[model samples]
Target: MNEELNARLLELLARIEPLLPPEQAPIDWSRDVAAIWQRHALGGRLTAVAPRDGVRVEELVGIDHQKQALLDNTRAFLRGRPANHALLWGARGTGKSSLIRALLNDLGDEGLRLIQVDRHDLVGLPTLVQSLRGSDYRFVVYCDDLSFEGSDDAYKALKSVLDGTLTGPPDNVLLYATSNRRHLLPERMADNSDTRIEGGEIHHGDAVEEKISLSDRFGLWLSFYPFDQSTYLAACRHWVAHLGGRFDTDAEAAARRFALERGVRSGRAAWQFAISWVGRQ
Candidate 1:
C-alpha cells in the first residue's frame, strides 16, 4: 500500500510542474498598443490599450511645430542617444495629452511602448520602474494632467524618478508628463507672501520653491497655448479633409460658431466640433 501511494503522489507532481512555469512567466508586452497601470495592495496590474481604440498621430492638427519637437525627442530616445524627460505644459483643451498619445501610436511599431501611470498611483513609481528596467523595449512612463496641491506629498516619488534618484532614471525609460500649470502647481498669492529675510534680502518661501523645483526636474519643457481664429479654422479644415471630405456645408463657418460658443480655441475644441459636425450630417 505504501509503494502504491508514493507512485500516485509522483504522478500528480509531474502534472502540476507544467503549470508552474507559465504562472511565473513575465508580462507579454508585445501584443498591445499601450498599458494602463494600476497599483493594488498586492502588486501592480496592467490593462492593455487595444490598437483599435488608440488615436492615430496624424489625427492632431494646428500644432505641427510642437508635434515635431516631441517626435524628435522621442526618436532620439529610441535611438539610444541622449534624451531628456519631457514636460508638456500649457492651457486646457490644447492637446497636451493628445500629442503624447499620438506619438506613442506613431512609434508603436518601432518598439516604443507607453505605460500610462495615473497621478494618484505615482507612489508606485519605484515598483513600476523596476518592472520596466532591463526590458528589451523603450518605455514612456506617462502622467496625464499631473499637478500638485498644498503640501500634497505625492509628487515626491515622481521628483526622485525625474532627476533626484542616486542612480538617476533608468536608461531604458523616459518620463513624459502633461500639465496645465507650467510649475506643476497652482500659484497662490499667500504662498509667495511668506518670504524669508536672509541678510536683509527677501527670498521666496520653501513651499514655492518646492513646487517650482518639481517642474525644473524635467529637462524638456514644451508649451501649448490656445489657438487663434485662422489657426483654429485651419485645424478644422485638416480634420474635415482627413475624415474623407464628408461635410457638405461650410465646415469653417460651423467651426467658428462652435469655438465661439465654447469660449475656447484649442486643438481639443476643434476635434470636439468636428465630431459634433460630422455626427449632425
Candidate 2:
C-alpha cells in the first residue's frame, strides 16, 4: 500500500514538471554597446541597440572642447583611473547626447557598456547597480534629457543612488546624464519668492537648494551652448563634404534661410539642412 502511494506521488510530480516555469536565462552583457531599460507592470525589460547604429566622434561638429573633455574623461575611466560622473547640460540640439554615444562607439574595444535608464526607471537604479557591480566591463548608466518636476519622487530615488548611501558607486560604473536644464530640475520665478531669514542672514528657498544640489553631486559639468551662424554653416559644409556633395551659392543661401526660419542655429538644425539638401540631389 505504501509503495502504491509513493508511485502515485511520483507520477503526479512528473506531470507537473513540464508545466512549471523554465529557469530565467542569464543576462548576455556582451551583446551590445548600449541598452534601453523599459519598465513594465511585472518588472523591467531591456532592449539592445547595435553598436554601429551609434554616431562616430568624427561625425560630430562644433563642440570640440566639450567633445574633448568627454573623451579625455572617458579614456581616463577606461584606464582604470578615477573619473567623475559627468553632467552635460545645455541648450537643445547641441550634441550633448551625441558626444556620449559617439564616445562609446569610439572606444568600443575597451569594453565600455552604456545602459540607458529613463527618469521613470531611476527607482530601479540600486538593483541595476548591484547587477553591474561584479561585471568585468565598465558601465556608464546614461540618462538623456533628464529633468525633474516639483512633485517628482523619482528625484529622491536618483538622489539616493547618486549620493551613494555608504558603499558608494560600484567601481565598474558611472552615471552620465544630459539635460537642457543645467540643474536637471524645472524652476519657476515663484520658487525664489519664499526666501527665509535666519540669524539676520537671508537664505535661499528650499526649492532652489533641491534643484541645484542634484547638479552639484556631479563632479564634472560640461556646458553646451547653441552654435553661432558661422558654426552652423560650417557644420553644414562639413556634412556636405562628407556626403560627397558641394554647397553651391543657392544651397548656401537656402541653408542660412532654413536656420533663420527655425530661429535657432544648432548642430541639429545644421544636420537637418544638410540632410534636406542631400535628399534634393
Q: 152-222 in candidate 1: lDDT tens per residue? A: 78899999988887887789899999998899887876665765553343655765688789899998999
Write candidate 2's Cα lDDT for 48-83 as tens digits: 767545578878899989888888888888889989
Candidate 2 ranges with C-alpha deviation above 4 Å: 1-25, 41-43, 52-54, 194-204
Candidate 1's TM-score: 0.84
- RMSD of each predicted structure: 6.9, 5.9
Any residue pairs clashing in model 2, and if so which?
none
